[model samples]
Target: MSNQQPGWFPDPSDAKKMRWWDGNEWAVHVSRDGAVWEEPLVAKTIGLKRRSRWVWVLLALGLLVAVALLSPLVALVALVVLVTGIVGISKGSGTWLRLKSRRTAIGVTAGAALVFLMAGSVSAAMVPGETGAPTAVETAQSAEARSEATPRRTSTPTPTPVTTSREEVVTEVIPFERSTVEDANIARGETTISVSGQDGERTITYVVTVVDGVETGRELKSDVETVAPVTEVTTVGTYDAPPEPAPPAEPTCDSNYADACVPIASDVDCAWGSGNGPAYFDGVAKVVGRDIYGLDRDGDGLACER
Candidate 1:
């Protein structure tokens, strides 16, 4: 029988019921006339223990129901405790007779009871006065009805004004420019102003935004040149004068003789005739002015006659 595979088998104490064999021992589950239910094998012999288990189960169920009606949070906690207790007891001992398992069950039952009590207290605190007291909606409606029976005066609020204006023209100055031009008529290294510069004017249009009588912002709408600017013209001299002619060179010959050159020396004579001299003139010579050389013998205008 110890080596037999797990299966349903006839109960040793009852012929009408079949008990599940879990290979190691008889399981707590039994079927009678094809209807299955969990029943400890020792339940028949210990009726007192069975009754005590029913009492605990019934008490936990009652707590769960009561908490569920009062608060869902408490109800969820009670459900978890109940499931944990059932599992712990089931796994501890088949008959729930172990001291530790019984203590666990009792603790779970007590925790559920505490949660139910707390939920009840919270539910009672939420409602003011007694059970016959008016609800929150009823109280609010009564207050509203009482206020409607009377009226009070209220002041009207003043409004702020915002204004937008377009095409607001603003004038601005446009400075003149200066330019240079080369003139050949003027002397070199000299400069003179041809046209005096005059400043110009321009007008700018804008879209202005004002809030509460104060200017907030403005956007450029258009720009127009009211007066054209005059450009100052400067004349720079580029003319250079031609160089002067060089002075005439001095004459090399003497200016005393008119016809031929007569050598100016201590004594001058003709070259063809006999005249002992260091310097001599061979050509015929004539004296227009005083004869400086005294070469003429007959006092004629001729000297060194040949």
Candidate 2:
């Protein structure tokens, strides 16, 4: 649509290439190959000057066809494009009638726009929400309505209640896990080994079993994962201890000897001795049950014999 220079001229550097000047007394040319120049189309006629002018007709036709095939909503959009194309096609040139001011062209465009929009709206409104069937909301409403419309049937099918005996209900027996054993040199007395876990506590009543610090049986009341349930565990020992040698009859001095040689079972070499002792190394005797006592000092709870 633009050329500022005059007629065709050979580009000084190349004979095949060309430069042109517009006819409005500017320096330009009219040529594709300077060998045979093309006469420039005058800009006075809008459509004749540029390739874009031709596109409007094509665009308007395409839009018109689109409007016909699509729903009103989409058709409305195509219609706007078609009308705008029509105005642009006029090219603002004076026709057989008169030249149109840009403003007048714009107004004409807007008017055509309003008309098509109205047509599209009217058409879309008639379209149904779905395939004529009600939506979930509507279907629910209809079902409710039918329920109210029908008369109530007082007698209905009654389901028989089935009873199951304890033996019939297959029980899921829960297995117990023994936590890590926490053994240590325990003083001679009753010690509570923490029997934790829900199932452990529940089945862990009076008869809670502990085989080598492991729970063999228990009823867990809570989930096995949480809750601090106390478990009664009995750590039965392999050996037992007897009552302390009845406070040995008062140690007596040998009638002719300077001091009493009567044996005094002092807990030396035992945990009570803090390294300070008569230095006499002996053995240890571990007692387990209430009535059992042993004198085997090598951690072997036995009686009498060292």
Per-candidate local distance difference test? 0.71, 0.42
On residues 178-219, what C-alpha lDDT tens digit does candidate 2 reach at each position?
443333444444454565443422122133445555556544
Q: How well does each candidate superpose onto the true structure, as a TM-score? A: 0.35, 0.19
Tens-place lDDT per residue, model 1, 1-306, is: 689899999986676899999998888989987799998786467777778789978976776576656664774565445444444444453233234557767676457546645564566676556476444335334544554543544578988686866558899999999999999999899999999999999999999887877888899988899999999999999999999999997664335666787766776767876778787778877777777666676877787664
Q: Which stretches of candidate 1 lie over 4 Å from their true place?
A: 1-163, 166-168, 210-217, 253-306
Q: In model 1, how large is the Cα lDDT of residue 123?
A: 61
Candidate maximizing lDDT: 1
Q: Which ten residues in a row have the lowest lDDT in candidate 2?
A: 253-262
Candidate no. 1 TM-score: 0.35
Top-TM-score candidate index: 1
lDDT of 1 at 190: 99
